[model samples]
Target: MTRVIDSAGSAYFGEAEGLLRAMRLEEALESYALAERSGHDPDACAGGRWMCHMLLGRYERAWEESDAIAARCKPDRHRFWDGKPFEGRRVIVRCLHGLGDTIQFIRYAPLVRERAKTLIVEAQPALKRLIEESRVADAVITWGEREPEWDQQIEIVELPRIFRTTLETIPAKIPYLDLPAAAPIAAYDGATDLKVGIVWASSSYNPARSIPLKQMARIFEAPGTAFFSLQAGAERSELALWRDRIVDAHTDERCVVPAAATLKKLDLIVTADTMMAHLAGAMGRPVWTLLPFHCDWRWMKRGEDSPWYPTMRLFRQPRAGDWESVVDRLQAAIEETIKGRRLVPPGDPGAQAT
Candidate 1:
């Protein structure tokens, strides 16, 4: 632990990771904060710290730190623009985390690739192969025995701020994900009504970000809404209780391909603060994203409208774990959407009815 403190005492790249793994969240966040103030380019470690702050429900501070990080990186945009484009420039998208992250960041692939001939680095074997072959990247490289050298590389999460996206300019469009085709699955032969893709839980990154599986019973109370299970990882086991109401897409072998296809079939996706929410936004699908009392900054500071995906309607918890209120508000919206009263973008005077 002395070495851990020593690492934290200095502006080291892997310091936050070690501190985080040691469960010193507050200390880790503080260390990152200190590093940023001390003329350190916190880089991806800074991003991780912001994510931790959000996960721990310290949102105001998280937003403050994220804004700081964004400010720090702003100068790079100019430097990058001044340089020659892709003439030996290597813009690296570090997606070696999970499928949802890769899926979420894939929205920026086209723009990043346009700026520089790019190489995508993915950890998951499935996504690595899919991204390599698909239209998302010029080339895809998986983590291997050697770290392939590159001239200039940026994390995909940085793309939005680099593009200067605000509440008015979210690149919200669907089919952002393009996976290879495989065998077709059974159609969602539910009660041919309002199809709602339900993602109650996420991979165990932030437990606070997820709502309980049992709380989903509140959504089922919405009459005539067909729910499909989109929960991935260990959370998929929770679907057994809602077997009748759900279509089992998680068990399928062609995981990413079918999931993307299934998302195309849905009228609406109701999800938590996971990558699915981002995926739904990317696809430009009509979605209701359930948010924590203090949400991820991309959802923006206020209102249900997300710049990330204009079609996505946000339902925030009035307080932590207040899924009842969140679900109730979403239910009313779903009822309206089902009856042809769509949830239009906020600020539309006509969007509000008497």
Candidate 2:
């Protein structure tokens, strides 16, 4: 059975939409390419293609497509066009997503800032404060409250590859974040055993991609490992079944302070694909990330490590939503950790071994 239809451009749009809905980025890219080749308006499919590439970690391709669209877009008063005067001389990053991604990719800010008078446009108020705190950008503007009119813009997601990033290229220095001391948090001193921080789920929008809370219960089973719940919101309700054994850090903001003092104090952070993982990785903290079978391509296909963060280790599902095998592997690794074993270093063959 053919996945794409060729009838009256129905097949074309159908295939593109289906691939996009399924998050089959490469397939969607090909569909968009075919659409463009078949005399369809390239701009009509550019935005979809751009998003697909961005999701797939095809930063260079995404930027190229985004640039193509920008070149074709009539110079309007929208914020996207704000960086025109500084175009060739500097890079303008159009920010995307929550505080985590902004902080994760902010590693490239100095690089871009070095080359261009950088301006970051964020969608959240927290992001604006975080960026300013880190001093990552020359200007940290918000997409909240005010939508500044711009002459040119580029997506922040495309920065890493645009700077020609690889695994070795990640800036692994800790304390890159300059969180102020308005609210101070003491180091995790309660646990006498090896502290293990955990995050059960990411935002609900990507449920299929997040490890279920039930699956996370197994992590606490590892011997002598003190598991702390560093999650927000539903953290209390979800981990309540674990009772006193689990550390309830969510009662106060000190648990997951923006400065990351709590996460940094832990020996390891086991989390799903969320800002916590990104923050932990950026801090050069040992992080094991549980991903869905169809994970973001930045994890790459069947990889033990991530190029986006040198300290990150990937624990991808063998099958979608089937966290059994992935959780089993995590359990085994944590057991080894409890046994005084180093628990296979990231990128080691043994680490990738299922």
TM-score for each candidate, following the candidate numbering = 0.66, 0.74
Query: What's the CA RMSD of model 1 in angstroms?
Result: 8.8
How far residue 142's Cα lies from its native spot in candidate 1, in Å, is 2.8
Give the total clashing residue pairs for model 1. 3
Q: Residues 262-290, candidate 1, lDDT per residue (tens digit)?
A: 87777788898876777666666778888
The model with the greatest TM-score is 2
Per-residue alpha-carbon lDDT of model 2 for 172-205, expressed as tens digits? 5655665554343453665556788888778777
Model 2 error, position 49 (Å): 4.8
lDDT of 1 at 190: 36
True-vs-predicted CA distance for residue 291, candidate 2, Å: 1.2
List the global CA lDDT of all models: 0.64, 0.67
| TM-score (C-alpha, index-matched) for candidate 1 | 0.66
How many steric clashes does model 2 contain?
11
